[model samples]
Target: MTQTTGTAGDPPYLRIVATIRRRIADGELAPGDRVPSTRQIAAQWGVALATATKALTTLRLEGLVEARPRIGTVVAGSSPAGPAAPTAPTARRRPSPAPDTEPELTLDRIVRASVEIADAEGLAALSMRGVAARLGVAAMSTYRYVPSKEDLVLLMADAAFGEARPADAYADADVPEDWRARVEVGTRTLWGLYRKHPWLARVGSLTRPLLVPNLLVHGEWMLSALDGHGLDPTTLFDIHVLLYSHVHGLAVHLELEADAEAATGQSEDQWMDSRAPVLRELVDSGRFPTFAKVVGSFEDGYDLRLDALFDLGLRALLDGLTPVVEG
Candidate 1:
C-alpha cells in the first residue's frame, strides 16, 4: 500500500490514505493499531472531515483496517506489507524568523507551540527546532525568551501541569469531603488532563519540582487536604507525591498505546488479538499458574478497563493511611 511518490501528484484523500498505508507497511503502524479518527485526520492534515473520511474508507476498503467498537478503527492484521519509502520525516528545514514577528516570540507563544507539536506527535518528536518551525520562527528565535531547549521544555512542562488548576471559587471552598477523596479527585483530574495531552508524563523530576504556580497549587491543595491527618508534613507530601507518581507512571503506558495506535493504527484490543496465539502458547506451558489462569479467561485477559485498577490502588493506599490517621 505504500506509495513511492510524495503528495504532489496524488489526490488529497488518496495522499492521506497512502501516507497512513506507508506507516502501516513500515513497522510504524502495527496490526490492531487504532486509525486516526476523522476529526483527528482533518486537524492533523488540515483537510476537511469528508476528505479524511474518504481516506479512512479507502483504508477499510483495502482490508488494511477495521472498526473496533470501543477502541475505534484499528489495523486489520498483524503482518503489514513493507513500506515503499522511508519513514515520514517529522522535521523540515526552516527559514529565518520573520523580523516583524520576532518581537512576538513570548514565553506563552513558545509554550503553546510546543504543546501543539507534542499534541500532534509524541513528546519524543518535540524539539526546539520543531517548535520553532511550528511557530513559523527560526530555531534561535525561541532562545530569546527561553535560554535553551531544556529551559523551553521546562516551561512547556510547567505550562502543561498548570492546565489542571481549579477555579478560584472552588480553590477557596472548605468542603467536608474526606482528604483521600479530595486527593483522588485532583489526581484523577490530572490523569484525565494527561490523557488529553499524553506528552505531560515526559516531564521528569519528583524532587526539585518546577515552580509553576498552578501546578504548585495542586500540591498545595493535596497538602492542605491532609491537614487533619496526624502524619508529618513530609510523610503527607510523600503520599501525594507517590499518588502523582502512580498516575504519571501508568500514564506513560497509555501514552505509548496512544502513539502506537496513531503510528500503527492498532488498538490495544487489536494488538492483544494479534498476539493471542503467542500468548496462548506461553500460557499453555503452565510455568506461571496464576498468570496462566488469568489469561485463560477473556474477562480477565482482555480487559482494557483502567477504572478498576485506579480505584483498587487508590483504595488500598487510602486503607493503609486510615490507621495512621486514626492513631
Candidate 2:
C-alpha cells in the first residue's frame, strides 16, 4: 500500500507522483502492475480529483506508466529511464510570466481555457490553478479576467451552449413542415451537443435550469414547433419539458460512465462481466421466474447502447404523447 505521508512544501500532485515513482523503483509495484486509480488516490491522499488526475498525467508524461483499455493504468514495460530514487520535496516554483510575445490574456481566452480543461478532463479535474498553468500565467492573473472560479464556470457553460444553434442543423435543408419532424430535429440537435460535451449534462436540472441565451434558442425551437397545435399553454410547456428531460436524463450518464471508467479502470462491458456471477445467482433463484426467462432469452449478452436507448425512448415517448399533442 502507498503511504500518504509527504512534505508540506511540495504540491500534492507532485508528492503523489514521487511516491508512485519510488514504488516502481523499489519493485514494490512491479512492471505491468495496476497503479492506484484516480478515485483511490484521492481517497487515500485526501486530495481532490483534479490533483489525482494531475499526478497520473505527470507519471504518464514521464513514461513511467501507460493507460490500458479496460485495464486501468499500468507500469510501463520499459520506462524511458530506469526507475530512480524519489527526490526530496522542494519549494513550489512560481509559474513564469508569459513572454512579451505571448497573446494578451482576455476574458474570452480565460473561458476558452477553462472549457478546454473541462472537456479533456472531466469537470472534477478543472481548477483555476490548472487553467493558469495551461495558459502559462500566474494563478492570480486569471482572477482579473474572471472574478471567481464559479463565475468562470458560468461563462464556460454559456460559451459551450453557444457552440451550436438548433436552427443551424436544418439551415441548408428545408425546415420540415410536420411538427413532429421539427421536434425531432431540435431534440436531436441538443443530444448532439451533449455528446460533444458530456460535462454539459451535469450543469443544470429541471428544478433549477441553466438560463443562458444559447440554451433558450433550443427551447424556442421546441416550443415553436408546437405553437399552432392549439394545445393549452401549460400542456405545451409540459410537453417541452418532457422532451428535454428525456435527452438530459440519458445524457447525464455520458460523463458518469467516463468518470466510472477512470476511477475503476474498467469499461462498461468489463464492469458488467464482473457482475455476471451475481446475475447468475439471481436468475437461478426460483423467486423471479419471469425475470429469469427474459434474461435467458438473450443468445448474446445484452449490450446497453445509450444512442440506441435514446432513439427507442424518443420514439416511444412521442407515440404516447401523440394523442395529447394532436388533441
Candidate 3:
C-alpha cells in the first residue's frame, strides 16, 4: 500500500514534489490551477512546512510551477507549453553605494533574514556566511549587526515569538476572566507558535531558557492566569513551566522528524516497516501475553498522533493542577 505520509525512503519533500508532478502529468492539477500553499501542503500531507516549501521550490526548478505576484504558486503553463516562467520585470537601476558609504544593513534586517533562512531550512543549515550571502553582502558584514551565529539565533527566535500573540490576546477585546480558561488559551497559543515555527522548540531549554521580551510576554500571561489562586510562589511558577514543557517537549520532535526524514531518506512508517520482522516475532512469541494481546487488539493500527498527544497532555496536566491551584 502506498503510504501517504513518510512511508518511503525518499525524503518527504521529494514525495511532495513527485506527487505534484504526477498530478500535473495526469492532468489532475492541470497547468494553471493554483497549487496548494506550503501550509496547505503541510496540513494535507502531514509533512513539515519546510518540506512542503522545498517541494514547491523543486517544482519551480523543474518548471512545473511558477510564482505569480498576486496569485501565489500556480501550475507552470496553461497548456504545458514549456513551463511558464516568471515574467521579466521592468528593469530598474540603482546608484551603487558610494565606496566610503557603509552598507545599508541593520540588526532587524539581519535577524529577519536569519529567521527566514531558519524557517525554510532547519537551524543547522543556518550560518553567518549563509545569512550574509542571502542579504547580498560580505560574510563579515553580518557580524557588524549580529556578533555571532548563536546571538543571531536568539534574536531570530525572539523575532519569531514576537510574530505571535498569546491565545488570550486573540479573543474579544476583553480578556478571558477565568484562570483555568486563560491558562488553557495561553498554553494553546504557545502550541500554535511552536507549530508554526518548529525551530523555536530547539532554540532554548528549561535550564537555559530564551529570555526574549516577546516570549516573556507569553510567560507573563500564563503566570498571571495562575496568580492569586492561593498557590505558593514556587508552585505557581512550576505549573507555568510544566505547561510550557508539555508543548515544547512534543514540538522538539517536529524538527527532529524533518532532520530524520532528510538523513535516513525514510519516513517514520518506512523506518518502522523495516523493523516489522522483529516486531512481528516479538508480538507472536507468546512470551509476552499482554503485549501480544495489545498488538492484536488494534482495529486500525495505532496512530502516532503528536497533536492528540499534545491536547491530552495539556488536559491531563491541567486536570492535575486545577486542584493544586484552587486547593
| TM-score leader | 2
Task: Please give the distance, in angstroms, between residue 244's alpha carbon in candidate 1 and its true position after superposition.
Answer: 1.9
User: Compared with the true structure, what per-residue lDDT tens digits does model 2 show for residues 27-93?
Assistant: 8888899888656788899987657766776678678887554345689997565333345433333
Ordering by TM-score = 2, 3, 1
Give me the candidate number with maximum lDDT: 2
Task: Extract clashing residue pairs from model 2.
Answer: none
> What are the lDDT scores of the predictions, listed in order?
0.68, 0.78, 0.74
Of the pair 1 and 3, which is ahead by lDDT?
Answer: 3
Report RMSD (Å) for each prediction in the order shown.
Answer: 10.2, 5.3, 10.1
Whole-model lDDT, candidate 1? 0.68
Least accurate 10 contiguous residues by lDDT in model 2: 86-95
lDDT of model 1 at position 50: 47
Model 1 residue pairs with clashes: 29-264, 32-266, 32-267, 33-265, 33-266, 33-267, 34-265, 34-266, 34-267
Off by more than 4 A, model 1: 1-97, 166-174, 207-211, 262-265, 299-301
Q: Please give the lDDT score at residue 263 for candidate 3.
A: 53
For all predicted structures, in order, the TM-scores are: 0.66, 0.77, 0.70
